[model samples]
Target: MEEKLSKEKIVQAAFQLLRENPELEKLSMRKVAQKLNIQAPAIYWHVENKQALLQSMAEEIENHFVAPKPKENWKETIYAYMENYYELYQQYPCAIEIEIQTIPSYPSRLRNLDAILGILNEAGFSIELSYMTITSLQHLLFGMLMDSSEEKKLYNKVMAGDDYLKKQIILMKQYVQEHELKNISESIQYRQKEKQKDFFMKTLRVFLNGLDTFV
Candidate 1:
């Protein structure tokens, strides 16, 4: 007997395609249908269009996120939540891109956002401040992941004997040294020596510490 087609099945298929390709633009209903051995029009019955499919895929990703339990200190709760969130994003290909293209209207996404904001509110933050805090943290996570993704691509090219990027890095370092830009030079060296996960945690701690004064 043929299996039933449902939103969940469609989303899973689409996500599978995304995992294989890791390029959002390359995902199409036709392709998804091909994967499922169904006609392209069948997907429209569930997803409406590509944008909706993307939103569904994003929600599917969010559904896997395991938020930290509430802590005595709200900062501890937030820190743990962020750490988990970063790892969740790392598990999926093009996860950040899927998130960037979707609205946070899905049940899972809203629940997570509400929980974080509620923690901030209970910690004596104004609604506006809580919103800003969550937004800023998201920006940090997304920006860092996006940068890491691009860096990985560049690293691959460098590994493939791409001298242009290597030369650019050398030129920048030489220019910094010649100009005696001590701070920039030192920061570059420090970043090179630090693991990305360690850097993220250090930055997260710094941000939370700064927020301590405001609370």
Candidate 2:
């Protein structure tokens, strides 16, 4: 008798593919099967389609998070949450890409959201405010993580300098030279590095500070 293919195996294969190529747009089910030493039809038995494969991958990633125990202080809880969240995704950069397309209907994500909502409410936020707080942090993280990928894309595009709408490239090069600035490609590369710098803590501080007056 043949062993049945498992969803975990399929997701692991897809995740390995993602590690090699973070561009989610380029990922395909057939490629995942090749990685797994299985037929593409075998993958279909596990995941109905690519979206389902993504949802399973997302669930695997979200399930890694171990939320901190509630400290008496809500601010501390919030800080701890963001710190843990950032570190978790840092290990799986492709997980960030998985989350960008659609929010996974995974229990882990929903549980984490519920816990955070409860924390915000306990911290004196109104129900609506608590919901908003969780949502705001989610979006902030999404944008922050996406920024690095975006800068890389721009850098890749500009590397084809001659192909990049010749007039704009020439003008940009002239402006940089005139101002003694780094080339646009270099600027984008620098921003990519800057994105890796410690940013989540500082950003959370600023956001919470704003909450001081608003909440």
Candidate 3:
């Protein structure tokens, strides 16, 4: 007797694989099948294709993004929603890439986007502006998280000792001198931690201010 394959089982296996793997670079149906000790053909019985499997994984992540209910104050609601999304992505780094590529037409993803738009609409943004605001907010949050993770790695190294940063700074200065670069201070200032936070915060404030203009 042939056993009936289960879609839920395949999705669970895929999710487990994603969680265990730090890099989602090799997320393939073959790898999933290897994890489940099943043939790739058997996986096809459940997931239509690799894209469909990724879509399913994306839908699950969107569920997390939309879990928070709309709040009394629009700004507060949006702040919390963005915070929730950032926390989720931080927990599942793969989510950053997944959210970037997933189609908004999918039911769960659409519902999440609609929820965000609903908040902006309640805040008195026009329909078109609300759409723009929602996407901008998402991109801003994702960009910050991604940039922070990358910078933090370098930051840890630099903080490890003055000698490390000195060596790198000396190399950079030599490169700049050889290149006859102007505004080395400006370049260094831009890369400084204080400047990075100020830029991120200022960008968020500007976005919120623009949202205010829509009101």
Candidate 4:
């Protein structure tokens, strides 16, 4: 007998397709059906359409997230949560894109958001402040991952001898130096000197420290 097809199976198949090809544009119900050895019409019966499939895929990713246990120090808890969240996004190809495209209606996403808000509330932040904090942190995390992903792709092309990009990089560096833009030059050099994770954590700490003053 053929194995049963559930939403779970369909979502898993879609994840596999993403793993094999990280480009979000290439993902489709037809491709997922091909991966699962099913007809495209069958996928529509369960998922309705590509947007719905993406929503399912986004929820599936959230389901895997294990939120950090609450700590007495709210900053510590928030830091841990952000770090774990970063790693989770890094684990899946096109994960950040999937998250950006979907609404956070899933249980896991809501639970995690609630947990963060609770932590901030306990830390003496007003509801407005707590919401703003979470929103800012998410923007930082999502923006970082999106930039990193695109940067890696560009770097790969450079590694493959993309002479045009190489020349552009050199020219940009030269422009900065020739223009005597001390702050920008120093910042670029500083970033290049540290590992990306270290830089991100340092920035996160700075943000949290600023928020601490408000608390």
Q: Which pairs of residues collide in model 1?
A: none
TM-score of each: 0.89, 0.81, 0.71, 0.91
**Candidate 3, which segments miss by more than 4 Å at Cα?**
1-5, 69-72, 149-170, 173-206
Poorest lDDT segment (10 consecutive residues) of candidate 1? 15-24
Tens digit of lDDT per residue, candidate 4, span 1-215?
98888889999888888888778989988899999998888877788888898898889888889888876799999999999898888788899999999999989999989888988898899988998999899999999889988998899899999999999999999999999999999999887898878878888999999997799
> How many residue pairs clash per model?
0, 0, 0, 0
- Residue 213's lDDT within candidate 3 is 56
Clashing pairs in 3: none
lDDT of 1 by residue, 119-156 (tens): 99999999888988998999999999999988987888
Score each candidate by Cα lDDT. Answer: 0.90, 0.80, 0.73, 0.89
State the displacement of the C-alpha of residue 207, model 4, in Å, after optimal TM-score superposition: 0.4
Q: Per-residue error at 173 for model 3, in Å?
A: 6.9
* RMSD, every candidate, angstroms: 2.1, 4.0, 5.4, 1.8
Give lDDT: candidate 4, residue 103.
91
Q: Pick the candidate with the highest TM-score.
A: 4
Per-residue lDDT tens digits of candidate 2, residues 48-148?
99999888888888899989988768877898898898888877757677887656588899898888888788778998788788879888887787776
Q: Model 3, residue 7: displacement in angstroms?
A: 3.2
